[model samples]
Target: MARFNGTMVALHSPRMNGRGKLMFSRAVLLCLFLVLSSLPVADADAEQQSSEKALREHYDLQEGKRLYGEYCRFCHGEQGKGHAFNVTPPPADLTSPAVQRKSDIELAQTIHEGERGTAMGSWKWALSKEEKQYVLLYIRWLAQSR
Candidate 1:
């Protein structure tokens, strides 16, 4: 038997003493402390990642609105009702069912490759892929706002 912190502890081996028991208890406590301390850090990391994603999405939408104002508003009009400029055949009313019915892929293609025989020109040389996507997002928002 060995006395550790005024408590009796039975030992089967002669090599084991109060000091060894104390060291083992300390080691266990250290391991528990390390594990518990890491939990909050992991939770904080997940929260930060979620927050970053939300902020990125919000900024992307804002950029989309800005792009629409700069590029599409002249032809599509302020509200996408079209014909802001006096172009022949007039630009398509973006909020109309005919235009909104088109899939995102089709809309993106038109933005990238231009509609033939119309005033709409290809933006492929002018805008990056991400910018095109942002424009598409703005178009969708325009439809929904109607």
Candidate 2:
């Protein structure tokens, strides 16, 4: 936003009479108020963004836990390790160094497309990107809490 340059405005104006001076002071006050009022808007926007990010993360953690229970527990087990059910292979231990070493993108991709020739099935048809991330974050939190 363009700032009000009072000096430039004043220079362009004719010499002020007592009444004009009063009007000029009022205009300057208005300009200052406008500038100052706008300053807090920037702060408010940043604060709002921070709050939204935190809220989303909180929701992801909660939803991820829920989703893990509903979809993953049958195989991955409650602790993200192998479950008792017999499949050709078992679910990956999410906390294992090998799995944890995968990049976030790689993890996301695996979640999206599942492991080929394994019990893991592609969730791409069922989960959104954000949903996948939530599960990923929950998986991370699992490792972290462990």
Candidate 3:
């Protein structure tokens, strides 16, 4: 007899039948089969969810590029390869994987909140929360294109 959670699994094969517990053994096998057979549905659901998330993210990235052109191109250039700046670190060469490796949250924070004491001025006053997210998606798109 094996117990899992609060249920006991009693198995009785022919060898165990000599012990007069063959019925219990059969019951346990049936229970195990029922439990195992029901698990694949959850796995299918998880795969479906993963696919949906990828599709949504892809669409958001497309929207992000539009937002970036409107709000960021003046300083970052049309390609985001950096343009204006006297000696300031040129706006990021956003196409680089090194720059894109940052998570979406990190990118959004940097764009919306800005890195202080540097020429990277905050856009919090200029863009809304959703706009910042779109910018992040645009940066991601640029990096992937490279």
Candidate 4:
């Protein structure tokens, strides 16, 4: 039977060695490693979720920026800091504690349903569910950075 010597996986399958043992062929092991790498890293600790969120979002956060510009920049301004308008009260300060304190569901609802008594418009039609998630993650990243 092929054996793992604690250094490297044996390249030969046990089937070839005629020992009747199930072996992890190098190709199978490589494929498993690659597949696992693409998936989200699971963690048991809640604190790790925040950092994992950043890592996952970092991959597509730039696309999130594009979504932001397409859906948010006009009113919320660059980075959702509300600098694009000189209007009274201005748009929502995305980085503010009040805004940042919102849960993901609240944020998504705000974006999808728009706020009452304001110029903000619902983006439910403009962005898909996944797109909304990306936007939210990007907004969170922006808030965290500042």
Candidate topping TM-score: 1
**TM values, all candidates:** 0.65, 0.62, 0.54, 0.60
Model 3 off-target regions past 4 Å?
1-59, 84-87
Q: Which 10-residue window of candidate 3 scores lowest in summed lDDT?
A: 10-19
Q: Please write out the lDDT profile of model 4 over residues 1-146, one tens digit for every residue.
A: 24576566555653475443334455677899999876655544555987788777676788788899888988888868987877666789999999999899999999999988777778888999999988997898788887
Let me know the TM-score candidate 3 reaches against the reference structure. 0.54
Off by over 4 Å in 2: 1-53
Model 3: per-residue Cα lDDT over 46-78, one tens digit each:
999999999988788877878887777777777
Quote model 1's TM-score.
Answer: 0.65
Candidate 4 segments exceeding 4 Å error = 1-56
Number of clashing pairs per prediction, in order: 0, 0, 2, 0
TM-score of 4: 0.60
C-alpha lDDT score of every prediction, in listed order:
0.90, 0.85, 0.77, 0.81
Best by lDDT: 1
Which has the higher lDDT value, candidate number 2 or candidate number 3?
2
| Model 3 residue pairs with clashes | 11-25, 12-25
lDDT by residue (39-98, candidate 2, tens digit) is: 999999999999999998898899999988877778888888766457877778888989
lDDT of prediction 1: 0.90
Kindly list the per-residue Cα lDDT of model 1 for residues 1-146, writing each as its tens digit: 78999999865456868888888778879999999999999999999999999898889989998988988999999889996988887899999999999999999999999999899999999888999999898888888988
RMSD values for the candidates in order, in angstroms, are 6.8, 6.1, 7.4, 10.9
Order the candidates by TM-score, highest first — what do you get? 1, 2, 4, 3
Predict model 2's lDDT versus the native. Answer: 0.85
